[model samples]
Target: MDIHFYKISISGIVQGVGFRPFVYNLAYKHNCIGEVYNDADGVLIKLGCKDIEVFLDELQALAPPLAKITKITQETIEPFERSDFVIRQSHDANSSTTILSPDIAMCDACKKELFDPTSKRYKYPFINCTHCGVRYSIIKNLPYDRINTAMGVFMMCDACKKEYEDPTSRMFHAQPIGCNDCGVKTFLHVNTTTIQKDTLYHTAELLKEGKLGAIKAVGGFHLVCDATDENTVQKLRQNKHRPTKPLAILVKDFAMAKKYGVFSEKEKEVLLSKEAPIVLVKKNRSDLASAIAPGIDKVGIMVASNPLHLLLFEYIDTPLVATSANLSGEPIITTKEDIEQKLPFVDFILDYNREIINAIDDSVVQVVDEKLCILRLARGYAPLHLKLPKKIDEKVLALGANQKASVAIAFEDNLILSPYIADLDTIESIEHFQSMIANFKRFYNFDFDVVLHDSHPAYESTKIAQTFDTKKVAITHHKAHLLSVMTEPSECVSFVFDGTGLGEDGELWGGEVFVAKERKYHFKPLVLLGGEKAIKECYRVALSKLFEVYPLDEVMELELDVVKRYKSKIPLLYHLFQSKKNLKTSSVGRLFDMVASIVGVLHEQTYEGEAGLRTEALVGTLTREKRFEFTIQEGVIDIAFDFFASDFVERFYATLCSIVITLAKQEEKKVLFSGGVWQNKTLLEFVISELQKENIPYTFNTIVPINDSGISVGQIMEYING
Candidate 1:
């Protein structure tokens, strides 16, 4: 009896990831005689087995682990007299364009060739085949062939063509295959001329000569320099207009990272993961320069991934502050024209002519208990959407904000959390977000049914949602925060704190206490603002409160100048707290801001969380750990602020000092230190000292982040149950 054969098409992140090879092996093992090919939509599989049931079971059940089989469709046809299974050249189904995958990190074989001087790709910055090299940034269309990519101009030579045609070879069907004969070249621009075309070695010399240059990294443009040189770093900071925000330092490898930051097993793994993300690591007292990460005790660091970075390290002995080549709070520009126009301050530009289809900023992460703490997921990690734990029936798309942004895609019940971070805080960022989402929809052939947006109504993200012609669900900013956390239902006293998030009441909210069970929550906003000026001025607010109680004018009968005369920092507080533009805020972050400002720890903040960070650093050094007394009466936990104001700041000049003294004399108390404010080292030191004197035990976040990033995960859990 004659049997019919079946042809199948599968799509969604199926290519480059060993999918075709896996299917070839599967078809061969199953005794099927049909061919598999790559098309616009995923992989195409064919089956012509005599025993249909066995062939179907084996093919369907034993798919590759990484292959995300989104949809599968098959058509039955007359069987061909084929003897063996093979990977035929890809056939064009004339399908829609596909999303470009990221450049995977160098595999073991590539890493081996990198050090071998005899290898063709030795010290080659753009060494890649299918396994690694630029993907999403280089591709403009689907079926992911070289003709559809930026590398199309560089044709394959005899050696590469041989490997590519040989089915038994690793490079078989590898689209990005390139050789020295036809590969990307680098040129150094000294002034207006593109000089130093011969080698990457001379580029290092120019950098050493105090020349500010732009380096074309594998995924994007990077501003490189010797981190040990104080002047070089300071100059970049001034030029980049990023003086206060700490720059991430890139080391040669994991071994070199040991010199500056403390890394556990989890941190090391994340540093070397395929994504090759930058992780925040705690600095040892004697490690690298204090100025590297200025206000905070922790520094962001990453090991070099691109081969060019490795080559640069060979010429220079010290680590480089390998930050993105762009202005502060701006998107990293990739095109040459943009480089010249935007980075006029740069001394030279090392550039190549290639089109970047998509822009992915660097991924930034932190380590917790040797595991990755994702702060910003970009580059090697973007477009890799996070799978939702729960399935929802509504077709929903969330337009997250530009800062700490994330878009949630819901289909039926399955949702996708598209990896993203805060945009560069500009009108262009909002436009980019809208454009990317439109692209995401086109790429997946899916449209938003009911859209969910943050309640920050004035935000660009919210505005984008309104533009969409779909049902809208405006999730409160804080609710999104709570829902993002606790993906599962659980009863817990949750403390959500951060820089700022829009709350249900149309005010910037961050510090919050909640009794949560699934999506059901009763939230109480902490740190009330006295008026418009108290927005971020935490210290000024406290001073205002103290004045109300102490009656400053009566305390010392003198001119209004007398209150301003002590130069006690109270005058500035008055001006700040009473200022019209200061704005009102009931956030815990602002509360810490006030404390840090008042305690003489920080007068002005250069970055969003700098004041809190400096204060925490100081606390870590010498903490008396004085546990403040409070009472939980009638559903409300009330603490007396009278001591902090009337007695503490008025009659006594040093309340923090007194708190330290009190804690130092105690013993055996269990001290709990948390909130984003605890990220301050100095406050932690004080808390630690007091706890130690009293023999108090303490635990900092290991399973959970001590920052607002984790607050959303908690929020997720709280809402998931509902």
Candidate 2:
């Protein structure tokens, strides 16, 4: 038999996900003698076998569950004779092109092993295998090995070492494979006592008794309490300063999840996906605590993403509110010191030894139009990489929008986005954002040729962009939003809406409908009062909208609940509105706030999109056929129609859909929608329905997020396209 020798290289998401071990086993199975190793670029394999074609085919076809091979190149090479297949040590080079895998949910094999009574890992909280375990969060650098992670501190016991070394074992070359005897250990704290015995059981018991505490997970800490207990959930809200905003709940499984929220098949698929993101579904059980997600008709639910979470569920019957362990507008807590010092309200702490290098929050997603739409990209869905339509030769850094912030670095043809950074409002959040950028740059050895940021001069992210020692370019906020979803440049009528972004005209723009290819068009500019303060107070926005057409006396006399509720602030707001003391905004977000207030559903905005989400939620059983008339005067779209809040909300959405459809039909083009407002499921449904009715070929955000978290990608895209 004639033997052939070959060297192969594979790129993309090959490190830290058991790619080397997979290749080692596959080569051995094919009766080939070879060694596989991870390098700075990707996975490298050398094989000497008689039939190389079959080996290569099975290598790609029978790859591990977590392996994602993007590119593979092979060539004939002089291979030395080898006695056996081996997994070589990783090679550390000067440059990095390898993609990092996001954190994965615990696999079914690990789950079964964890619960098996006779198994050594019985009821082990940290049970994991090669196919499933923490990856991105624990990893500090590339060439993903145990030494580069927090798990480096724990030395594998003899039993674990044997399993890890044996080629026939499933745990072979599993970087995170460890049992309770040698892996990460969990410790529980109750009141003033810290106990290592039965930590998971104690934590579960405390949760069952309606206690609120911080529990360390794969990514970071989560403040948890019984979701079914109203008092406990209310206490959590009061302590966390998270009022009215919906909190994500962690259920036992799909069966328990069904009790709280109704899920579609697609939504179910996402819920059960390896990512295990928080899937937003329609609210069903009214018995859940109202404080969990007050005023909203939808709830975010997540099944167990880790063995620890599943272990806690064994002793508890009800769902748990597993919200991020951080103060409002701050980053999620990753360390024990941060949790103890920052969160004094937590009653107890369920801590773990394994360190989380990259502190990421849970990813939030919803199935929109049967597609999994990412809202807040993190955890299982982040450190995302995408190939641009055209190669970008310049090494560029993009500081995303201040709200829902994320950073992006473009090199070659790849755009790498960091996990979701919380809104850069407070000093802590800004520092966190800066740290993320610094870490990313250092990790990839990136030096910027140019920096891209929002056009808004006062934005924290833009301010950071200015401090960078590189050529700076500012992209209009709406333009970035519109371009973020576009793969290639095309003529399309785009509808971009959000709370506020600096327009090219130096005014705050949000409600914009324009020809994106031309980069010019009309907007519904509203009278904004009190500048930045108007964002928190929905009444001010409502008063401004009312005073736009009606006189002060007439507006005061109007039977609006918001006007009556904040009568004292009305006079001052009116004075400011007349004096033009506020920033002019063409913001659809403010319109939602105004309508939410005017309809008496909400009075203030405690969180981002609170008013808009509430308004969308209130459109409950209302028919979609009802739409109010809108006047497009000169070039601007005027929504100065008189209607109650509920009717106004529905009408506003229908009118926007109609406008986009009409504009698309007139221009003979497809419609593209982007922005934070696009996260509103109701409005998106309406627009999609309208477009489908007219058979319009409309494009929307599916790959990346529609919110400001996606702004970084758009900024980079803008630079590349230009």
TM-score per model over all chains: 0.81, 0.97
Runs of candidate 2 exceeding 4 Å displacement:
620-625, 644-646
The numbered model that scores best in TM-score is 2
For model 2, how does the per-residue alpha-carbon lDDT over 282-369 read when each residue is reduced to its tens digit? 9988988988899889999999979999988888888999999999889999887898899887889999888889889999999888
| Lowest summed lDDT window (length 10), candidate 2 | 620-629
Clashing pairs in 2: none
Name the runs in model 1 displaced over 4 angstroms. Answer: 1-12, 29-31, 39-41, 50-81, 88-100, 285-290, 390-394, 412-414, 419-424, 490-493, 517-550, 553-584, 621-625, 633-722
Error of 1 at 117 (Å): 3.1
Tens-digit lDDT string for candidate 1 (1-722):
44568887775667766667667766767667878877766677777866766765665677644345655677887777888888877766533323346666666566677778897777766666546656767765566677777877877888888877765666666677765566677777777676645557787787677666788876568887777777877888888888778888888888788888887887778888877888877885444545578876777888778777777777766677778887766666777678788888777778766666666677777654333445665667666543456665555566754355656554532344444534536765566666667666754566667776667777667788788887876666655554454332133333344566776656766655443422122122343334533544454545554454455444234233323333476555545544544444445566556555545555445666776666555542222223334343433333345333322222121233233233323322332333454444344444455545556454444323344433333333333444
